[model samples]
Target chain A: MSQLKLNTEGMKPIYVQIAEWLETEILSASIKSDEKIYSQYQLAEMFNINPATAAKGLNILADEKILYKKRGLGMFVSPKAKESIQEKRKNQILKNLVLELVTEAGRLGVDENELISMIKTSNKFVGGRDHERN
Target chain B: MNVIESRGLTKTYGNLKAVNNLSFDIEENKVTGLIGRNGAGKTTLLKLIAGFLHKTSGEIEVFSDNPFNSIKVSSNMIFIDDKMSFPASLHLVDILEAAGNFYDNWDAGLANGLIDYFNLNPRQPHSSLSKGMKSAFNMIIGLSARCPLTIYDEPTTGMDVAVRKDFYRALLKDYLQNPRTIIISSHLLNEVEHVLEDILLLREGQKCMHMPVEELKELAICLKGKAGIIQELATGKEIYHKENIGKDSAYVVVKNDFTEDRLQNVKLSGVEITPVATDELCVFLTSRNKGGIDDVFDRN
Candidate 1:
């Protein structure tokens, strides 16, 4: 997948948006492991961002072992990049949802029991008939 | 080992000291932004480095050799000025051919691709193109030439917003592909601020400030609060600039060592702080009337 379109008007830096896009593509299997990624120049051209900004995003992926470079060749997705990204995404979502639920509960002056019940009800709706089997 | 280095570099044209005692080192493989007001000697500095003009005093070195009429050193550097001239009778194809022979690392494919992308007709005479189109053609050469030390002095003069944006994008893209020392001098301050890694600000033909963008941002703050409280807080400190609207006042300055508790006790209704931008910083620095290097340094 190409780099996600960035909202220049947004307060967040464009590089952060680029990193998020790459992570999403990796988790969704749109960019498979061992697939060749666009060079920094191509990415900069496509996004209209400074190469330094593009390089910073790619460096983040490299740090996560999502992408690796071959000397004189080009950058490619790591062999286990998909699995790694998936695991990371799962953890991130869980952490974010928990934080959101706690914050919402506190704001509404609801206790832990009330929050757990709300979660159970939502899970039932989401799981559908599978809730009965569980 | 300096790609470009100058010591007490001064250039004077009759009564006007176009460049004054400026000294800086431009390291290899890094992009530096040359910025200043219209008569701030940015063009003069570029010309000196490109060896198009002789300096009045001091020294300049490019790749450990003087660039004045030295073909070996000059070939490695390309200066694309706003008033860049070519033979009016020559065709665009001939210009490209000449540039290809001039630079050792010229990429014909990139030049051809850019020519097509910009919709430039190679068969057209050099003088026949519109001013904006001519600027675009110059940009094509700057990008595709692949010079190690490329300097652009207001290379986007007559281009519209869209075309200018395209040029910036192409510049960034090409720089990433081939990392080198590039200096861009332009008056469109805000547009180029994001792409610039470092800024060399000049005023009245003098180097006022040189710092990395992030570092410079950290040093400046825009503070708004009660006029009385702001005066008290700003007392015995350097106030670069200030604005007042009745009871409300705002002060811009380099970040100082002031405690929040002290400011809180001032009983101001509110205090809003934000980072000062490069352009704002330049205006503040150059707005002073003193005509000396010390005055410039003091303001900065």
Candidate 2:
């Protein structure tokens, strides 16, 4: 029941929150590829949101081919769901975070060279396990 | 079919038009929130649907037929108001038995389960229970009735915050198990907003806004920055509220979302953009000092 957490005060809409949560689940392999993910009803129960909102969230994944629906059954993860989700997140979410970091750094008078070295130093800490897992 | 439909619905009491020329169709199998300030006609509209009050002029259709005193509509709907009265002589058990006979879709098992969950003693009379207890009992009946078009007007009137959360959890659980058209009119927007599929906002007897809750959030945004900078940014934008937070910084809600290009100014101007909750939007939309609709039409 407590597998996924939500912030009611978060700025993102509920549907977007649901979608991102599903992505995290997929990436973490908690929901294996081609396995049955939550039905709208199950999601509605879990999040205490409208089933339609939950459906909208599922639809986002379906639209992106990360999830596929079966007739008379629930949605299933696409075989390449994790890769696709990671690719999309890296392109969009991670990019946004980096942009904000760079912008904040500039505001604080930190130069590009300093920021790059900081990123490099941070990257080395996760060196072997991250690449091996990927 | 639309679960409930109102076309040019007008209900007036003497000089006051409680509901003015309102037209909206509530779709089946969706939870819609009917919200307004006190005396803004939420109860009047629900009462009209529940067959307790007839509209002064115009139409209200429930399940494709006129609802005023119609047995058909009454059979399919249960209107739960917090202070709903039961015969004082009849005990809670008797009322529960009577409720089972009234609604066709009633689930006795769910009724029993909810009774236990809320820790109610069925032997106690309705009049003897405290306000919070009364509300909890009302909720048990409403949830167990399983009516197709169920309406709850301020169902959490006297319940504490913990009990309110439990009620919402039970509501979502039941709703997931059995889909129905549910309408709740409550002042606790922050607690209830997540459960709502759409919001039908009323102000001074007129339908001010009707849209999905997500869209409502997108339609307005809160901006914070230097007083002069915010003032400049607010020009040509629909400003909901503006106030100086300190000597230099100010908080402003404008009718727009800030973009990178939009907030790019915030960076140079030392301004910050932040989240605005729906409750704030609702307050600004309904406040008297805001001049609401009057301001829109007052060109001078």
TM-scores, each model vs. reference:
0.72, 0.92
Each model's fnat? 0.33, 0.70
What tens digits encode model 1's per-residue C-alpha lDDT throughout B6-102?
A: 9999999998999999999988877778888878898999999998998899989998888888886788888887588999999999999999998
- Candidate 2 per-residue lDDT, tens place, A58-122, comes to 99999999999999888999999999998999998898788788888988999999999999988
Would you give me the overall lDDT of model 2?
0.87
Each prediction's interface RMSD? 5.4, 1.8
Which candidate has the top score in DockQ?
2
lDDT for B244 (candidate 2): 71
Per-residue error for B179 in candidate 2, Å, reads 0.9
Candidate 1: lDDT of A99? 66
Docking class of 2: medium
Runs of candidate 2 exceeding 4 Å displacement: A128-134, B257-269, B291-300
Give the TM-score comparing model 2 with the true structure, all chains together.
0.92
